[model samples]
Target: MELTYLRTFREVAKWGSFTRAAEALGYAQSSITTQIQKLEESYGAVLVERFGRGMKLTIAGEALLQYANDIYRLHEESKEVVSKQSKGTLSIGTIETLAAFFLPPKLQAYRRDYPDVNVVIQPGNEPFIIDSVKEGALDVGIILDPPFSDPELHVNILREETMAIIASPDHRLGELSEVRVEDLESESLIMTEDGCTYRAMLLKVLKGNQVNYNLSYEFGNLEAIKQCVIYGLGIALLPRITVAEEIRKGQIVAVPFVHPECKFYTQLIYSKKKWQSKAFLGFVELIGGINHQNH
Candidate 1:
């Protein structure tokens, strides 16, 4: 019956782990259990059930969750209208490149402007980020990807990131201003792990050209790939933004790979239906504003 109990229930449902939900909300695990118990009692139904190591909502819990979602959304909107509070959380799901290279300055500026806001950056692959945004778990999703669309999401292409095939400065391909698909014939390729969007793009370009290349190594991390290239392990395909500083320092050379297929953009995405708080809208505009200022 209490609004705080509803808030606690929502967090519990989101995490599915009393321990984790408590940590996220700064509550004790016992406190989380008590609140959920009260919430279930109010509805005269067991809302959550033990499932293996964690817990999940029962049929009743799932039904209650839908109404809880509506309640919280309206509650948040009402609070914003009454208090004009710009001090809530903004959770962003992003890929490795943006987290490490692109977002530092933008985040720093946002924090300075809205010191009361709590910003959370969650790093994951594109599919995970996309799903999180759609589920209302993440406030926004950012990626360096080719043009994308989802009927449920509002996708905005912030800017085009120049793609490049990077190699050690002293490598054989360094002299070339641009590397063509055929240029990589029989070359050793250090690749990102499967499920990477750009990896798929690069492989498509090579397979379409019938270029035979060796996969010397595969890494899921950006820095590891960069380190391998710096040591002359092999050439890699990555966004120029990821390697710009190394290129400037003469550790790596951006062999400026160009192809119509490999072009990717900085994107900002959010659910079309997700309630956008003032802080949420402010962070969104601040990202777009950075794009304009940079251009």
Candidate 2:
């Protein structure tokens, strides 16, 4: 069996979807399926079983997955050892919000110090980025709100962000200095999809207040949600840092909650067992130093 097939199987098992594995590896779905099939045939055992729209590993598959993880780790370590003798590259993952608002300057500094080091930036949502880091797909991930229950990872708090209610300038809530949760009962709301940290906080707050508001839409893309709110589709709750420029430009109005305040913490997360390259260490230092200096 090819080592590549084992790597593919590991990725598929980690994500629990052939389609997702294909996308992550930049392979066609058919190619991923064929690779897994060949691996199974060679072993004379089925590794995965279909479960709803996704797949779940059989008992044998789970055992192989454990071994696969260790093999992949050793593979990465070997590559790092050789690369250090020559040169090295850093693979960093970040959420869209940080990629847009915060990462550019840090990246510039990183490139300046290590002109020969290749830097790869993978952008995705919080969960995707975190999962990639946990699975050894990324060297490090800049994420918003640390994962709830992962003891194998280390998280360094980067910044604190406030959550605010946003609306177009002409919306009824826009004219208010502060609005109670009850006042939002009749307002149309646009929210991020489930699994988003902000979405969970917003729902908890609304539920706590016994507020029954109208939810018009749910989206995962920040820009799409912003555009919808800009066009007066509905009000939205999001991080203050994300809407700072829009609020300043008078494109949107940000209002504080009268009874409850919501906040989010941004963090730099990485696996505790993963080796941190010199380039990754430099970038982390740059971010930490700059934030400290400013404070």
Candidate 3:
């Protein structure tokens, strides 16, 4: 069996549509259909069936998918090992918060230590980064806590981050060094969008305490939210790492919540089945070493 055929089949099985698989693989749709047809002929068995508008795997297809996954994983592992012997490249994905605050120095050290290896960083939100790694679009990801639940992915705890309720120096709550849930009842809250884990946790805590406050605004970007808060638009609860400079410059005041301190774990996430290359392993080790030094 041709390896290309198996690869195409794997893509189809992952996405459930030839069109989607072709798009993801950057192959023509006709090429994807041809590959599947050729594979079916070689196996002398029907592997896929059309269910409604989408494709469903037959028992034979399902069985083949399992083997295909294993084969692809092994092939990738072999490639990584071989390429690393020649000193190749590594790809890493990370969310914006880490990209901005935590990863720069580590990445700088990585580049200095492994001048022969190329490291690429792709930054996005947690969900986007996790999906990219699972789909083989990226080698690894650094994500914020409340880790992704995909069984195919592996997660390693990197560090824990503390969140603080912050406001402009002139804001009403800025004078207080520490605040309770009840103290926030009269203030408008600015937060990230619904998909943000930190935002969800903050809301859950507030709801549990029967604390009601107006949601002044929601933003996807932390910088924008910080700007809004800096201008006294509303109070925002955000990671301390993200707002440390502002606090130091006296632009904002950070007030820790008294009960149920808000904390998030940072994790390193990657496809469980991926072959760990030398460069990839080195990057992981670098991150681990940095965390150890910090502690």
Instruction: Report RMSD for candidate 1.
Output: 3.5
2 against 3, candidate with superior TM-score: 2
Cα lDDT tens digits for candidate 3, 209-284: 8998999999988899899988989999887899999999998888875555365778888776677666767788
For residues 1-295, could you state the per-residue lDDT of candidate 2 as single tens digits?
5789999998899789999999999999999999999999988999999999999999999988877877877786788667774246678888777888878888898788888778888987778888888878788888777334478777777787666789999888888887677778878899887777777777777899888888999987888999999999999987777899898999999887554445466788778777655666677787772233322
TM-score against truth, every candidate: 0.86, 0.78, 0.77
Off by over 4 Å in 1: 44-46, 289-295
Question: Which lDDT values do the candidates have, in the order given?
Answer: 0.87, 0.80, 0.81
Name the top lDDT candidate. 1
Superposed on all Cα atoms, the candidates' RMSDs to the truth, in angstroms, are: 3.5, 4.5, 4.4
For model 2, the stretches where C-alpha displacement exceeds 4 angstroms are: 11-56, 85-89, 115-125, 146-149, 178-180, 258-261, 289-295
Model 3: per-residue Cα lDDT at residue 232:
87
Displacement of residue 89 (Cα, Å) in model 3 is 4.9
Models ranked on TM-score: 1, 2, 3
lDDT, candidate 1, residue 197? 90
